[model samples]
Target: MKGGATVPIGLTPEQGQLQEAVGRFAARHAAVDQTRDSFEALAEGALPKWWNDLVSHGFHAVHLPDGVGGQGGSLLDAACVIESASAALLPGPLLPTVIAGAIVLSVDDMAAAKLLSELAAGATATVVLPESGDLSATATDGGWRVTGASGDVLGVRSAAVILAAARRDDGETLWFVLDPEVASASVEQRDGTDLTIDVGMLRLADHVVPEALVLNGIDDDAAWDITVALSACASAGTLQWAVDAVTEHLRTREQFGKPIGTFQALQHEAAMLLVNSELAAAAAWDAVRAVAEAPEQRQLAAAGAAIMAVAPAPELLLDALTMFGAIGFTWEHDVHLYWRRATSLAASMGPITGWSRRLGELSKTHVRDMTVKIGEAEADFRAGIAAVLDEALGLVNDKPSPLGDYDHLASGPQRTLIADAGLMAPHWPPPWGLGATPLQQLIIDDEFAKRPELVRPSLNIAEWVLPSIISSGSEVVQQQLIPPTQRGELLWCQLFSEPGAGSDLAALSTRAVKVDGGWRINGHKIWTSSAQYADYGALLARTDPDAPKHKGIGYFIIDMRADGVEIQPIKTADRDPHFNEVFLADVFVPDEMLLGGPTDGWSLAIATMAQERVAIGAYVNIDRAIALRRLAAQRGPDQDAVVRALGELDAYTNAIKALGVRETIRLLDGQSAGPASSIAKVATSIMLRRTFKATLELAGPLAMVERSEPAIVAPYLRLPAELIGGGTRQIQLNIIAQMIMGLPRK
Candidate 1:
């Protein structure tokens, strides 16, 4: 929500009707009970025939053109049916059918129409390739033998033709549509799901294929692109179906004394999953509609959407499963069906890592230029590096950050280009300087936030520390510190925590007794970010000896280069420290260095704390998490969609935890975007904890199924992260109570 597209797309009535129709179909047909057996059959080499029934009922024909023997409907219509079938766990050679239709659609003339027409009539059609283990017309004996065995075909036995990719002797890549039964090969029984469609090995030993079998008449690359696009659509459809099923389940299923769906945690999980489903849909939708966009752009967009897909669908399904507990995992339980579909669909499409690599490659070409990542702290300070990070409870940034990465900023009056547009400080009167309102200011912040690139420029952060100096220091100190700091004359680090002082802020024993014009400071701080680059720092000193603990502290802006100051980078679990450690041995801070009135430092510190919390919450990206869940949901049970669902849910919950911190940032800014952040933290934990609990519960006896490292890793990953982060659920509730509700703090 923080950086979502500002202008939303509204759907037409027809689209609404189409969606409803799809939903109705899912309601009537979704069945999870047979999911496991069917997938087991598929994995072992048998696929179901009921899948053929759905295909025959016009599932694949919904989107082909009228001349193609279809309803001549839109992609939206096709997707609706695909999604519905997925929700129901009906199996067909969907990959082949959709891929074939795509190849047919790419034809330049009546040939395409003819191909589509034949396929839409339920004639089995597929793409034959090395990717699918078959080749075009070329071989060792002069006639190309499409000699290869396709051990696993989603709907091969039912398919009259298959789409296969192969490398020619000259190394040219080609696709062919070959008939397996006719090929000089053996089709032997292999264990597959449900014992429906024949899942056999087709070993093409010198099997000849005709050049007419080539899908592409001219462009060799065309078929490949077609396959990618069509497969994306099918994957989208599968994910969407899982989303619908999970959404419905979340809305209806009850546990722990109420519909688990009603819980904020669950709803958020569902909401994120739904977002993923939308993304997958959007990817296919955009690719289909972007018949005009650049080929690479279209591919990138498709890849981006697909890459983020599977995790969300399956995650939501698994969440729903957990809510249903053991009943969901039972051979007779309804959830397994959706889970199975989700797993198979995901495995079929390829992994997210492949897509992410594509994304990273695309990013190299498309990343926008500007101050991103690092920024000058202030005017003339080129060495300065600054980025805004969300801090803990009661946290805040000392001033509006120096980073500006959002595109909209070029539209804003140049910072300092005009005195009217430039901001000086609380020092300048409203008449003499920028007089932006809180809302306007918030807009500036938001604009700075919503760039396609979310990071602020690293060149502008030289001044993040100057304002804190100006706010709480003496006149002499302000003159000595703020301006030069603004010029990047100095840098700063935060020396706040020690090993013992993590969340309990007031227990610090860092001493700095007043001695003449300066104070002697001694303490150790751990996990301070950016200390390696700082010339100065903000530190809290114990000033009061006998008064109440929190009230006796003083905030001091310190010179990092001061005598007795030391720094060390702290290593983290992931690796080297993003933050560092600082040890102070009787460091001297001049009297002018106190950040606020002595003992008033705690309140001054509150500003950055809240900002930090909200900033951290922004990572909660519910949308991102959901995208992943929907992806996992699209996988077929043949690939262990339920357990895969467990993996997906695990990923989604961690993502949700990041989002909750972002919401907290918003609340701290005084915008009541509902108590979603509070709700997010609470619900995320519950969803996470319960999702894992449900995983164990759903596994019933299978909780003991630690057959491999990967088998049970999903639940394990989801649970611990939920238990950690942002002061825990209990701590977050305390913030909500004390900060939002005016309740007494513990």
Candidate 2:
């Protein structure tokens, strides 16, 4: 069976090209059948026939310095090659060799030069971190005597050299480069789970290592960090292969009179698999980037990758096999090889719980910066925007309320300053906005973020609705609504969801009969947020009942205060009157108020909903994480469980933010948000739920009472709204499965 195309995982155009090139090379030289055929040779400590082919391309030296006989590329460059190679299940010691190379390069450059040049010339090496072995080093004349036994070490059998860590008598760790051919050294091959690589135990009996071979600049912690980073990249690659294989199977394999991909249950599972794969790739990408650009953040990034990608691979691949059914269980299928590799890799990475605790400890002082870097050309634009923001800041009386609150509109003068300057919606067209590119939009956001005191006026629902008016509305509609909405003078609500139609907006039964010079609408809209205060609503009503459900709807701008318009507040479980039910009885909307053609409402609604999903996904709320950290701080530092929970939450939070950054980059490159928006919506909802639940658990008895603390109890109560609103989580998953995975629609 042919495989589905691998999902794109590059962060830049150059990296994308490299990924493609390496993928093609792997397909041509190290395909799955070849990898399978080499199992016997790999078990016998024999290197792959294509090992030289790979080294000739400088794959092992991509991350090393040019002076060290490397390709002078960043760690991310090496990661692209590793991920692509792992996707093909290439049989060899490339991963361990790179890990050993990175650790050696970071410490002893002179020693690394020789080792790296050898590696670039097709010599393989393996690293044995302290966690993977028990060894001791004693200082002696002109050398150190090492004696101990290493646990199962990957690629040790075929390695020309072994970079192993041994503890001194004082409990300090020392790293040394030991030649495998040393007189007293021996390698014992072990039957490991992964078939594409050799694993063995190394025994050292008073083996003398020369002083020059002893690496002084590295320790156990640093070595493991390097190991986790590279391992994560390889694991992410394996996950991508599994995803592509399963996606192909689902697309072609049929049961129950149709393709299994069309089933909603399978589609949801497939969508989640894709989401997790994206998260894994993102964590790996972050780890490599941190190694290249921010040394201080390497541990934190690695811990995140460990929790989000490396440690979870085994189970994720197992889940993929279940999706493949009985055929996947057979030994002949290639899926089992990936599962075995994932299991072995996860085991090699050690326990995820420890990584989670480490992450929490690191996060107390260091945070992974999520700021988008704009080019130097935006420096002047940023300065000018800073001036305007400063002026607006001077006009505010105290700090303004949050942006999305219905009753917390910015002051009239402040709104005028911001809207007139086109800072309210910088991505909008000229006059109303600067017609700013995505980069400029990021810069504007950065400027506003600097001055937390100057709150931009909230458009609320208008933020989602006005875009439709701008794109599909008549000139009169645009002029009448856009400016005021931008200035916070006109608030809007959505009249699309009704009692009969919530997720299925096209099935709306509201009737809009054409009358003299206008149309009369009669409908009931439920769960309409801010309808009580909205000046107008973006309404959908069926103008032709006999036509198809999606074809006869009309998009209209309904006046909330018109005759026969009634808004009844619906008290939520949180006891807040934030949602309302709007009743329209013969509410007349003039012909000019119609947004597009009579039957064009479905497309317009879809566009509006897409914007809504993107808007929702782009907003990352880490308030729960912040609250949990604060609560944990008050509870003292002895709570290891709380720390681990915080770390896990931070990992999810980072992944979500990375998704947002990826979406922004896509937009910057003039690409659509695509199914990633839906994936984001699903991910955000799950993260929020987990975060709030964790916070409440941390709060203990204080969270039991409704009046104990609004922060603790209110968010937990309002969690259901997040699930149901903006298309339910299940609905979003269905969309993702169909759109991104090419699963047949239910």
Candidate 3:
């Protein structure tokens, strides 16, 4: 976990610092062997040697309020420490202690002040809720007598305070704190799967407790949400460790004359590990943030995290172990410990099926709120942007054409209004755009999203091309093309992918010989979307044939209507003529049309492709998932498979959204965007393909019909293009493996 591209769990600077501090502390104080040594101590019902060191550093009370003798940080802050500590395999009751503290804090502030103070002062605790056992409470004069056999609870052996839940005879659940030293209460250490912490069972035989210790404000759901959130954080940390360990192993370990990571199969597998780790981290971050800042969103976030991160964790760890080959299976290696821990954590959550059902049921009524935070300084900017969108909405409403109509010529004025106001491409430079920062871009998106009817016209390929054009095009070219393109008058198509050069565009043989005042383009491009409707095309051709493949190309703007330019529609599986084969025979492009230097085409093309990937990756359509949810709801909950499928789809969809939010925050924080875009591209493609396939399966026999709900069948058939369009899934995986994981290329 020290080096290599570990997908980050903490997003902000402070959180990152906290993660680093905890990581450094763990490396120095709680080494791997130290954790291994703790196995015996833990089994003997004794605390790890590093337990006092950890407590002295204030790790246990990071999330408690300052008034409670704590540092007054959010749960996310605590999550950062937990993730880092778990990554180091720190052996103690850190997780359960944090969970117990958070649950108490969430219920009663006054009680939390005392309990949290004790925790902050180095006392340990554990929680035993109804999910783990059937405990019953009987009312007494001044206290309640509890009786039950509790399930195996982590940290119970060393815990001074026990947070237990019991069902009263009146069908009401009572939550109370019990002193483990009580005479009638018995604590027995149990051998468990994970060796990093002591696990024990608590049995109470009419053990009396003070009413003062009772937490009447908390219930089963609230406690469960808190547990899931904190557990998810620890899960993220362990998954991260596996990712880093496997990645480093793959990078250095060689087979068949190269690093094993160089093999495409291994690379793809490693890339998937990164993807899942990222999704897990995002889910964990979102869940903890919801617990800290958004009380209303707690249950949904927790359920989402449980399915997205916690449930798949054990399997994800197993996948990592498989990637490590026989070495991972050895007792000497650390992978098995993570697998056991993940398995125990998942079990502690009481089955993922229940979580999936809860998520599916929640999906029917609630959507996760993904709004970005707007700061005070940006209030004026947001207001101005909102006012512009309001005007655009009015203009859109006044239009004669009905909404959703197929009118290529409709809403021209509305598009111009938005584009002229710089709302269309606010991230672009001024005049054409506001040269907006990432925050401003997000704000603009927020304002526009508020008024969905005032749709800013899709720029088609121009959305991918215009950035390069603005960055490298001549001033005259920019003046002539950018304004009109922004207004949606100039639809553009990419002319890069040749029959033989689909993913490897540098291998393209399209030729463009320099003529006196221009370049004569003669080549062919296939799978060109919207070529027939495009007013212009961005062409990549070899300007110098003798030079290297990537070194001799030129990027030129071509007039799709120019002489010798031909567009032939290619009917795809969906039977739509959206794709076309464009052939150019001596199509003349003037000197100004050539973007950048002649040899700069490859770099420019790469930049465009990067932007393309980002755009495609960011555009996750959960509509299919919603449609499936509606269909599943109609079929009722009896369809467990449908419910599970819906839950899985919703989980990945939110994971993708979480990635988008993480990326936006990363950019806003002035950090490099990293490989998130590439990761998103791969994850989104897989999620979408699975979602459509699941829809078809859930639809039963009706999906086989020719006209079976065009909504479902159309996307199913059209998904292949998505896989191949921006960049093939394989290509994206290669990018992620190499760039993010630091794996060597073949």
lDDT of 1 by residue, 628-687 (tens): 233233445322434344343433443243233333334445544544454455545555
Candidate RMSDs in order:
14.3, 2.5, 2.2
Q: After superposition, how far is residue 107 of candidate 1 from its true place, in Å?
A: 3.0
lDDT of 2: 0.82
TM-score of every candidate? 0.48, 0.95, 0.96
Largest TM-score belongs to which candidate?
3
Candidate 3: list runs displaced more than 4 Å.
1-3, 293-296, 397-410, 635-638
Task: Order the candidate numbers by lDDT, best to worst.
Answer: 3, 2, 1
Clashing pairs in 2: none
Clashes of 1: 103
TM-score of 2: 0.95
lDDT of 3 at 349: 90
lDDT by residue for model 3 (50-152), tens = 6788877888889888877787888888889888988888777889999998888867655556787888888899999874777888999998988988988
- Regions of model 1 farther than 4 Å from truth: 1-12, 22-59, 71-77, 109-113, 134-143, 183-190, 193-201, 217-292, 311-316, 350-353, 367-746
**Candidate 3 residue-pair clash tally:** 0
| Residue clash pairs of candidate 3 | none
